[model samples]
Target chain A: MTKIVVLVKQVPDTNAKIVVSGDRVDLSAVKKVMSPYDEFAVETALRHRDASGGEVIALTLGGAGADKVLKDAKAIGVDHIVRIDCEEELDSNSLQSALASTLQEMGAEIVYCGKSAADTGAGSTGPGVAERLGWASASNVTSVGFDGGLTVVAPSDGGNARMSVNTPAVITCDKGDIKVRKPNVKGIMQAKKAQVEVKTAAIQPSSVTIVAHSMPPAKPAGKSYEGGAAAAEVANLLRDEANVI
Target chain B: MTELIVIAEIAKGTIHTTTSELVTAANALGGSPIIIVPCTDASVADAAGTIAGASKVIAAKSDAFAHYDAAAWAEALDAVAPQGTILTSATPQSKDLAARLAARRNLSVVQDVVAISQNQLTSPVYSGKAMQTVAISGPAVVSVRANVFDAAPSTGSNEISVVDTTGNMATAVQEFMARASQRLDVAEANIIISGGRGMGSPDNFVHLEAIADTLGAAVGASRAAVDTWEAIPHSMQVGQTGKTVNPNLYIAVGISGAIQHLAGMRSSKYIVAINKDADAPIFQHADYGIVATWEEALPVLQSTLAGMMA
Candidate 1:
């Protein structure tokens, strides 16, 4: 059977107001949900497992609260859920190492994840994990078709490129024609009773460290133009002041 | 002085603009970086040698280097650049290559870096909600955001060095394909004009295109417009779930300034919003705003911009 693993993360709702306090972001009052893109990842994994006759497992490396995202994945038809209970911030290198080892232990042949984390926006985890495992990897894949091999379509400069890769590969999903499916009543009820198997991950020493956090310099108030007639002035400002045109 | 290595990007045997931008970034960090051009031909080294502020250019050529195979590029770069910080442009190909190099070297990687100093680098985290400054001690890999820094101009000619690997390759690219020519990606363009549901229909995008052509800007769309209209493809989407752009000038027409949309283009140097509702949330972030319908304002604006350029 094809053993597929989908990596997911819990992030603040896209509309949540971010409050920065003393070089740290405060998320005390923010509501967290499955990252929007991860929903697509979950959908992709379920479809692949169903078509290929395999088991789909949803995994996350986050704190206790991260269980919510796993549970959400269960509601979306994932068969198994696991969470690596850790709170320490991991740099990309250490994180990829930890996850690669975990996936290896599980004997997962195909791995899927969102192109990037909504919070960090570092679209490196999937490819990073693939590299650590010495496996083929594709990023920003829009569509997936399997016929003896995995064929995926990813956006290029202006068009899309169709690529083929062998299994034991990592695919970072992008929102394309795949519209994430919604959970039915029965699925939601079953997910509420599902248990998330939690375990600790071996945290590795980080090479990069966060020294400080600050707000980007605020842009000065821009000059306003009244109506369509102000277009000439806008053009002049774009050419002279901004030097963009 | 510390040594810096830059991974030069090449297109059609010519150095990409991002390579010059990397040179500018390296110059800011206090070093004359050596450029590494990985290509199928050694002649591309001539183009790499012309980049300003570079000390030397290393031409890494192999049959497997014809197309962008992340594994091949990573192996090639790792073989030549054993130590020191390595920098490249932050694109899908380069980011994948950087991540692979980081894993292979077991070093830290700072992706999409916007500012770099001697030891500290600043990059946007949480989709531009906050910025994190990281401290690096030993070897590291970093990818800079495109168009954020000025492209270093051609100044001094540098020496070229070639490294030939006739048979050494781990992976090979079976095919290489690119989008149609002359279409600037939203992320790489200096100016972008994006439309939203306020545009009313897909037909109204032509108005945006008229202005876009006049200003040499790429056209983008809000998620709302893309989702609502079948004519608008996901490729044109610029939002939290779509392409994140850091253009110089961003014009939002008929967009309501959704936070998701703001996350993508808020880093743009200049923003202009045109909507009929004076209370549209987009006005809060726009550098300049006009309270008029696109119908009433676009034609006049297009004509005025054409006249200005003429």
Candidate 2:
């Protein structure tokens, strides 16, 4: 059977207000959920496994709190789930290295992940993993199909490119017609009993270091206009003050 | 002297505007700036040589580079780039190439950097909620956001040096397709007119396209519009899950400001929001907000912009 792995990350809800204090971003009060885009990734992997007769394994690298996303993945029909236990933050290089090694050991032929983590928004892990494994990769993939061969549709500039890559490849999922299905009552019950396999990974040394953090300069207060007649005034401001006209 | 290398971006035999911006960025650091033009054609390299602020242009040409392949480009760049800082415009291709190069060199990539100094770089983290300043210990790869830096003036005495590849390519492009002519990418557009779900239907996007054409702007969309309508592709999506746009002017029509959407465009220099709901969240971030429906405001705004431009 084709072995597939989907990488998911737990991130603060998109609407949470991020508070940056000193050198760290304070997220103690935020509600954590599966990174929004990872939903599409999980759905994509399950579809691929169902079509090709494979076992879909969901993997996540985070602290113990990340088990919430793993159970959620199990409820969504992932065959197996594993979590790499780590508390300290791992940079992209270290994270990708750990994932590449783990996926290699699992003999995974196909790997799926979100294009970028919502928290860091680095958008590098998928491609970095591909490079580490010496495999072909595609990013921002909107669709995947199995028509005698695996075909992926990706958006490029203003057009779309339908691409086909060899196996042992990494594909980053983007939103498309695939609406992530909700877990049914039975699925939720099954997920509650699912056992999450925990594993330890050797953290790699980081090459880049963050020295400090600061808030972006706040935007000036907005000017509100009342009616359609305000169009002329807005245009005048665009031309005179904003100089964009 | 520290040798700062810039990977010049070439499209359809011409240097992209972002390459000159990278040159300007490279000039900010105290070093001898050089441009690396990796292309199949030599004329594109000659075009890159004319860019200002660069001391020399190294054109790495090979048949393997006839199309855009990140692995091949990264290999060519690794071969030509000296032991110093490497910079490129933060496009989809560049991001992939930078990541590959960083992994190959055991270095870290600072993606979508907005500000840079000799040793320190500042970039948006957590989808623009906060900015992080990182210190580079030695050689590193950096991808810069387009249109953030001024394009360098064309007055350089740079010479072009040609190098042939060894034909050791791991990946090949089966085909390359270009976008429609005159369509600007949201990331590089100076002005953008974006529609949201409040516009109600896919047919109403024509209103945004009309205004975009009038203002020479690109047409963008919030994630809601893209998810709701088949006509709006993911490429037009501007949000945390989509492309982050830093256009000079961003005009939102009928968009309720979601934090995810704001994360992509909150850095726009000026914002104008139009929504029928007076209490829409978009008005909070907009510089000038119109408390009217797009149907009531777009036509008048379009005619007024047409008159102004005409």
Candidate 3:
């Protein structure tokens, strides 16, 4: 059976009001859920597993808040799950190292992750893991498939490029892919008993640090260009003022 | 002085316009900056020479480095920026690479920054949901979004020393494809005119395009407009997580002005909003507000302005 691993992150929902307190996200009123992009990764893995008959493993590193995501993954058809609950929040480098070690522990023919976590919008975990593990990786992929090895559709400078690669590779799923499917009633029932192993990360010397964070400035009030001829005023603003041509 | 490393991206074998903006930003931080050139293209190296504030330029050449790969970049950065902080544009490619690099270093990745200094950093949180002020606690890696800072004029002689650092990483770039566009980038445009869902159909965009053509300005859209309207190009998307712009004048038509959409163009010196709804959110941000149908309003503005131009 082809062995596949998908990296998942539990994040705040898209519509939630995130309070930026200092450099950290103020989670006081936020409701945590599986990051939306990870759903694409999980969907891609399950689709591949369904088509080629493989064992799909879901992996994550976070505090206890990530349990729901693992459960959601199992309900959605992941065969196995690993929850690496770290003592400290693993930065991207430490997370990559830990994931490399995890991938070594659970050898797989392919690995997948979301292009970015919506909450943080970091867009780094997949590439970090791929680099640390010395695996070839592709990111911002809108579509993915395994023909001889791997074929993915990714955003290029102007349009999309279909990329082909071999196995033992990493692919980060981007937006515009098919929306992820919800878990069926039977799958949800089975997910309750799915094997979940929690491990603590062991790594040192994380290079990145979040020193602070802030919100964007308020825009000055707006002035409307009414009527069909408003386009002319717009033209004037663009030429004489904005110079954005 | 501590060494500052700036990852200057070159698209299609040439230095991107954002490179000058970033180098100028680094100069404001009071340092001779180091530029990292990932591709083997010689013209890109020459363009780095034009960045008047740099002390050194490190060129890493490889087939694999040409494509935008965060993994390949992490390895390259590991080789060059082991002890120093890695800085990049807050673009999609750079955001991914910087975050992953920061994670590998076990440092926090600060993103979407509008302002940066030695002690304090300003970035948009919640996808332009709100602005937050952060302080650096450690030697951290940072990714700054384009248009966050004023372009700093070049001040030094055009001397560049090249360093090679591709030996540490063992990967090659398979390919690179550039996004094609004839209009100016939203971030680079001095004036921008945007349409919202209220523009109706893709066919109606010709009017907006005509205005844009007249002013020689770039056209943009909110997320809703991009998703629903066929008129706007994908490259002209401006929203919370989309391109950030700082034009001198911004004109919005039929847009209600959600906070997320406004954040992208809020930096524009002048803002004009046009909407039929008296209570449109856009009116809250517009310096000039006209409450009328875009179809009706646009023609009046066009004729009135055309008469003035004539």
Candidate 4:
């Protein structure tokens, strides 16, 4: 059986009215959900588990609030979970180390994660983990399937770049693969009873940290270009005025 | 004076344009750069010799070192950094290498750093949302985001010193599948028109395509736009991890600029946003914004520009 670990994060649900105060994400009015891309990892894991007959484990470096997302994962068919809960504010570097240690402890055969965190967009964590663990890794993968070995389809310049790679590798899912299927009412209730294990981070002393946060400046009002000759005016505005063309 | 190590990334047997740019930045600091090359392929080594200001070019050639691998590179760089600042391009592979090497060696790693003075350096925070200058001390490994600095002209006849790293690496690059050959990357385009999920369907992009063709602009997409895979290709995605661009003009259609998406294009000189909803985050950074559906705005704007050009 192939042991698969999907690294998921608990993020504010869709349509959450975001209020950013400094580096903290204001989650007062928002409910937590599994990060969108990480859902792809879970989906891929379940698919692998169904075919390969191994356990699928959901993992995250989050706080107690992360349990909600784990429940969601359990409803979707993940068999095991590990929440490395810590208040030390681990960046991608620290998270990578902790994940490496965790995966080594579990002896998982494969690892998967979203290309980047929706909130941080660091995109470095997954690849960083693979590097620390001495495993092959690929990002922006559009498709995947296991045939004797794992074959990952990565979108390159325009077309897809497919490579049949070995196990003990890390792959990050991009958007637009298959959307996550909603858990049935029965599945949700069953998931509420699933077991969850929490762990603490093992590394400290990060090289990067969030210094502060600020909103981007407002865009200027757009002027509507009327019909006919105005098209030429718009063209000129785009070329000579905006110097974009 | 401290010694500096520069890994001059050469692709397809030639030095990337940013090679000279990095050397120019390194020259301002205290150290004389010791150039490191993973592949000692003759053509790339000869090209390395032409970089104007480098003190010495160190070349390591092998099939294992041909393609960019973060693990192998980090290990190799760790051995080379005992001397000076180990500077690398902020390209995808370079960032990974720098981060892994720094983490492995427990050395200080500064990434996407734009300008470096003697003690203070400027780096973009929140994906170019704002620039922060910080003071630093000690042995540092830094990766420079290529576009942030000017591509220094290659004019000097610097000396080339080749080094052997044939047996130094254990990890091998089996193969490489690069897709950047098809579409114009955001980094290189002067004009870009981006779409979001609000554009609705893939066919709707044709309207924006007409305008882009008229203006000779490239097509781009937000992560949401790319989510509709049928409409936009993944290559054109402009966002935090996707691609960072500084185009002359950027037109965002039906896009509710998420902070992640904005991080990719906020540096454009002029930004125009078209969205039915005025409250979109994109409008906050636009030079011009129109609260109109793309279906209505795109055709009208395209025809208007076409007629005016005629």
Candidate 5:
């Protein structure tokens, strides 16, 4: 049986307005939710478990706040839930290293995660952790199959490539055709009472540091046109002013 | 001085323009870059050797290059790449290699770098809600986002090195299915015109498509459109949960401009919003706002745009 592990990250709700206060991104007022793509990964993992008879475990990073995503995964019927307990910010290397070691300790045979997290939008965890564990990684994937072996269909160069790999590999998911399932009332109640296993990882010195944060430069006010009469002007403006046409 | 290495971007066994973009990025960081093109044939090096701003070009000729096997590619590229800063364009293929290469050497990796100033790398965090700037203490592998760094005139001549790392690769390629239709993806499109559920029906997207065809723009959909209509695939979605785009011109028709949708395309150079409701949030960010329905505005806009093109 395959030991499937899906990585989930908690991110600010997409609708939350980000504010910068003194070189820091103020996310305190924003509500957190599961990274949208990670839900797709969890759904794929759940399907794999159902078809192949393997246990699916959901893993998350950070402090108590991250437990919510794990519980969300649990509510969707993941076999187990765990968290990496660290309060401090770790750079990309340290973050990937911690995740790599934790997966190794968990005896993970196959790993699944989002193509990239919505928070950082830094699609590193899958390939980075796969490299640390010396395993193959198929990223930006639509489908992951397990009939004869592990196969994945990933988009590349405006085409789709069907690839197969050995075990002990990491797969990063894209939405593809999979329709994500929502949790039911009974599942939600079970997840509300689920206890999460917490563990600490071996931290390493970080090679990178976030020195500052800022908002993108604001744009000047735009022109407004009313009714269909302005359509001709808009087209003319695109040519003369925007120079895009 | 730390050596700057650029991993050339190859599409369909041919060099891509992103090679120069990577070279331009490396030059901006105050270094003469050496580009390495991963391939099984040495002929690939000839074209890359001519890219401007690079000091040298090395073709890492390898059997592992038969197809894009990440494990094999990382192992082969590692042998030729020296200890230094690695620079590449943030494409799906190369970004995967960048992370694996960094992990092999125990180095740090920064992806989707939009700006580099005074040894600091800045990228969008929280999906473009806030930008984070990071300082690298030492050598790191960085992937620069396409169409961001400014290009300047530079010099380059022929100094080529070829390394052969022909080894057994584990991953096997079963088949490659090319998409039949020549539709451009929203991520790679220079111009995009997106529709929302307000279009009334999926079939109404034909008007958007006609407009897109005239301007050579890709057709995109809001999350609402993709959810409301099964005909619209998720690939056409442009939003936080969908593909993030940074096109030159983004046209939003009949969309209410949800924060999630804006989060993806906010970086577009110019935005045009067409909606019946003037109070829609999209108008707040659009460079040009039109208060009219698609049925009323699209015909004129399409004919006008077609006339301009003609």
Candidate 6:
């Protein structure tokens, strides 16, 4: 069976308000869920696994607090799940290194992950993993095609490019045309009782250090005009003040 | 001053406009920059030599350059480019390249840098909910966002050198088929018009496209629209998980401005929102707000703007 691994992350719900206090972003009050882009990745993995006989594994780094997101993936019928038990906050380099090591030890072929995590939004891990593993990777992929080999539709400079890449490759998913499936009643019960396989990786000291963290400056109370009557005025302002026309 | 090396982006066999922006960004770092053009042709390197603010241009040409394989491209470029800070555009493709180069070289890689100085780089973190500034201590690979810097003026002749890299490449990627042109990506567009589920139907996005055509803008969709309608592809989604667009003018029609959507386009210079509900969150962030249904407001707005342009 083709062994496929999906990199999953737990992020605050998209609608939750983010609060920053004392040089730290406090997401304690927010409800955590699977990162939006990863949902699409999971869907793509399941589709590929269904088409070709394979075992789909969902992997994450953070523990306990991230269990819900793993269960969420399991509830959707992923075959197995694992979480790296790491407590220290890692920089991009260290994080990528840990993930790359895990994938190598797992002997995973054709890894799938989101282009960027919703939390860091760094967009580094997927490509970084491929670089470290010395494997080919296709990112921002809108479509995946399988024709006795791996082919993917990715965003290029002007339009899209459909490229065929070798296996043991990393694929970073974009939402594309995918619609994630909702978990069924049986799957939910199975997921709630699913046993999570535990693993650990060496967390290295980070080269980069955060100087400070702060919120963006608040926008001024904007002028609201009622109805279609203000359309002409807004147009005139675009030309007169904004000069964006 | 640190030796800042710039990697020029080539799109469809020509040097991209973002390379000029990257050069201008290098100027901000208080260093002379060298341009590295990875291409199959030499004129692309000659084009980079014309982009001012760079000391020299190195054309890293290869047969493998015809397609992008992250490992192959990273190894090829790393072999030719100097052992110093690498600066390129924060564009999606380049950001991926930045990560690869940093990983291969064991250097720090900072992606999507909006502002930079001699010693530190600042970028949005946690999906734009907050901004984090990091101190640059050593050699690092930094990706600068497009449109955040001035295009370096004076396209003068700089010295150019060409080095073929097929000898250096361990080619793996194969058969790249480029589809014909589509509308501008929202991240690169100066003006954008976006629609949400509030538009009621995905087909109504064509109306948004009509206005976009009038303004030469890109059409975008909210996450809700993408999730609700299969017809709406995620490529057009402007949200926390989709794209972060910093356009000159962002017109949001039939969008209630969810926080995730706001996180993407809130950095736009001027925002104009139109929605049926009067209390929609979008009005708070919009410079000009119109309270009306898409049916009532779009036709008038498009025609009025068309008349002004004409």
* lDDT for each residue of candidate 2 in B170-253, tens digit (9 for 90 to 100): 433344456644578786688999999999998999999999999999999999999899888877899987788888899999
Going through the candidates in order, what is chain B's TM-score? 0.91, 0.90, 0.78, 0.76, 0.91, 0.90
DockQ of 1: 0.56
Residue B89, model 6: lDDT of: 80
- Candidate lDDT (C-alpha), each: 0.83, 0.83, 0.70, 0.69, 0.87, 0.84
- iRMS per model in Å: 2.5, 2.6, 4.6, 5.1, 1.8, 2.5
TM-score between candidate 2 and the true structure: 0.91
Residues B164-243 of candidate 6: C-alpha lDDT, one tens digit per residue: 87633322434445533267778778899999998999888889988998999999999999989988877788988778
Q: Write the residue-wise lDDT of candidate 1 on B1-310 in tens digits.
A: 5578999976556778889999988888778899988878888778776788988989987876765656666777788764778898887778888888888888778998999887888998877877899987777888999878888888769999888753333333334456543456676677999999999999989899889888889999999999899888777889898889988899999999888898899898889988888888888888888888888778877987898788
TM-score of 1: 0.94
- Share of real interface contacts recovered by each model? 0.55, 0.56, 0.48, 0.15, 0.76, 0.69
Q: Model 2: residues >4 Å from true position, as ranges?
A: A222-224, B166-188, B197-203, B224-235, B276-279, B291-296
1 or 4, greater by DockQ? 1
The candidate with the higher DockQ, 4 or 6, is 6
Ranking by TM-score: 1, 5, 2, 6, 3, 4
User: Per-residue lDDT of B1-310 in model 5, one digit per residue for the tens?
Assistant: 7889999888778777778888888987888788899988989778876677888888899878878877888888888888899997787677888888888888999988988885899998887878999998888999988768664343557589888885446577788877745788887788999999889999999999999999999999999999999998888999988888888899999999998898889888899999999999999898999999999899999999998888
What TM-score fits each model? 0.94, 0.91, 0.83, 0.78, 0.94, 0.90
Best by TM-score: 1
lDDT winner, 3 or 5: 5
Number of the top lDDT candidate: 5
Per-candidate RMSD vs. true structure? 2.3, 2.8, 4.1, 4.9, 2.2, 3.0
Compare the candidates by DockQ and give the number of the best one.
5
Docking class of 2: medium
- Cα shift from native, residue A102, model 3 (Å): 2.8
Query: Worst 10-residue stretch by lDDT in candidate 1 chain B?
Result: B166-175
On residues A70-183, what C-alpha lDDT tens digit does candidate 4 reach at each position? 888889888887888775765455667788898889888888888656554445666677767877776656677776678777643234557665557888887644667779
Candidate 6 C-alpha lDDT tens digits along A1-245: 89899999998887777888898778888899898889888988998898887899999999688888899999998999999988677777888889989989988887999988887788888888888888888898878877678888886655666777777788999877778999999999999999999899998778787887779768888778888867878888899988989
Candidate 3 lDDT tens digits, B104-221: 6656666766676765667655555655556655566777776556654555556554545553332233454455656656755667888888888767777777766766677888
Cα shift from native, residue B51, model 1 (Å): 2.5
